[model samples]
Target: MKRFTCQSCGQLLHFEDARCDQCKAPLGYMPEHAILSALAPQGGGLWRPVRGCGNTALRTFCSNHAYDVCNWLVPPTEEHSDFCFACQFNRVIPNLNIPGNMERWRKLEIAKHRLFYTILRLKLPIKNRRQDPQEGLVFDFLDDSPDGAAPIMTGHSNGVITIATKEADDAYRERMRVEMGEYYRTLLGHFRHEIGHYYWNVLIRDGGRLEKFRAIFGDDRMDYQAALQRHYARLPQNNWREYYVSLYAMSHPWEDFAETWAHYFHIVSTLETALSYDMTIGPIVDGQATLTHKSDPYLLMPFDDIIAAWLPLTYAVNSLNRSMGLADFYPFVITDGVRTKLRFIHDTVREVQQAAS
Candidate 1:
């Protein structure tokens, strides 16, 4: 995520900002230009970018802007569509008429938009239902049934990713984190993890990389439901960390791929944020050298360079958290096997990107 600033007044801006705080200039994110621009009203609900902001053409906020959920802009050419690039993928949004549902949907949108940020930055292929009805990316923000039956389980099926609205509640989410014994659980993590499954179908299964995937991730042909059942029924394996990113990843090759894939996104995206801020790490210990990020992790950086920067950055951040009596910022460890899997993911992404280009 690149740091953004108000083009008009130079006020620092966050990705979700709808208006610049210092100058009070309206802000909108231009996905094609990848900049948050200050807007000048043009007439009849249209806006133009302020001077120096990329794209001089008139634009309009996504229809979702009416709900204050999206800040992305829509070009005039896309007038036929009401949603922005990110919001267009929604197959179902939370029932806004229901109490607290709007807030939940807002939280979900923030995380989902961030997920799309990384996806677009990586130049990964994406198609909405309109493009490919069978396996195009889409989302369903659902609530558990009112009848007290089974709750809405957050997972991916085909191309549809269903997220439970309850996860947006901090209390409920934290409780589930403790109950599941997960070190990290957040709305963003859910999006990243589930999208990994969607990509596995697109890039590995349909793209003819299954053999290579099986080599690194193990045979995914093993029955998924049986693997999940056995995973929950058995005790945690002492050597699980040696081969998997998480205990749940040890359940099946498919899961291992998704977990590792999500971790890849986490690493690259966070590293990009660090780089945008020009962050560097230096320890005073003997024989230790200073670290600085110079390449774009999403495109130009070597996989080895990414890991080299990632480990030290995690160590520094984790120590900072410990100083404040907070849990480690990053709780997982990457072993040799996990590193190999991560490299495989990196290579696959670059391969797909190059082929697409």
Candidate 2:
């Protein structure tokens, strides 16, 4: 994601900032324009962008803004809907009666919004449940049962993405990561990985690209439960890194696709963040340039360019983290096989966009 600034005072603003810290100005994200803007009231509860001179469309903050969860704008035309593009997809939210549920929900929304930022940046198509109930995208932020019922597992089924609200708790999430022996795990990773499943259903299964998908990801028709049970019961295949991005990815072909897909988003999103900061990699010992500054990764940079920028950025970030005595920012390597899968995801996304257009 790119860094944003307050239009009123030019204060650097975070993606989730609802107000400018320096200028104390109200802020909202203009998804239509893909910008964060200072808001100037237009009377009668309407607002206009302070920066976009030509943008006079009357708008209001998303209803979720009441809970201080969403920073997106909702035009008057969409006011009747009472939700923003992101919140409209939520099928369920945590029961607020429980203490601290709101905070957990807030954390979940932050990650979810970042996920949407990348999807929108890619100009990928999305269908809400209202638009296509059968296959439309939806989200469920659920908590464990009150009576000690089974815990909610973060996964996707059909078009619905369910996240265990506990994952928002830093301690719980870190515990899970250590328990599972994962190199990395986070709320954003969960969103990216699950959404990968959603896209597989849409762009590949429904878009007439299943055969090609199978060719690249292998047969997803393998019994999912059996594969999962086997994965947990047995040790990960030897030299798993030679073929998979993570151990969990080896559970099934579908998982392999999702893992690779998530990393594709990770690579592109971080590269965009780097571009926002005008970052460049290095001049090697031989004085040969490597990963020079470039255009937006979403629209301008090609597959090879993204990898070139991403690899160096990962190395630099890892080194920086080591300097601080922290774990590597990115622990996995993108082997030749992983790159092949990532390319497939990138091409598939572009192909879907072309078809939609």
Worst lDDT 10-window in candidate 2:
282-291
| Collision pairs in model 1 | none
Stretches off by above 4 angstroms in model 1 are: 282-289
What's the CA error at residue 213 for candidate 1, in Å? 0.5
Please write out the lDDT profile of model 2 over residues 257-291, one tens digit for every residue: 99999998998898888888877785475776565
lDDT of 1 by residue, 1-357 (tens): 899988887877899999999989999988888888999998988899889975689898999999999999986678667888999999899999889999998999999999999999999999999899998999999998889699899999999999999999999999999999898999999999999999999999999999999988889988889999999899997888988999889889988999999999999999998888878564445887676657899999999889988988899899999999999999999999999999999999999889988
- For candidate 2, the lDDT comes to 0.87
Residue pairs whose backbone atoms clash in candidate 2: none
How high is the lDDT of residue 282 in model 1?
49
Number of the top-ranking candidate, with lDDT as the measure: 1
> Measured by TM-score, how close is model 1 to the native structure?
0.97
Q: Candidate 1, which ten residues in sequence have the lowest lDDT sum?
A: 280-289
lDDT of each: 0.91, 0.87
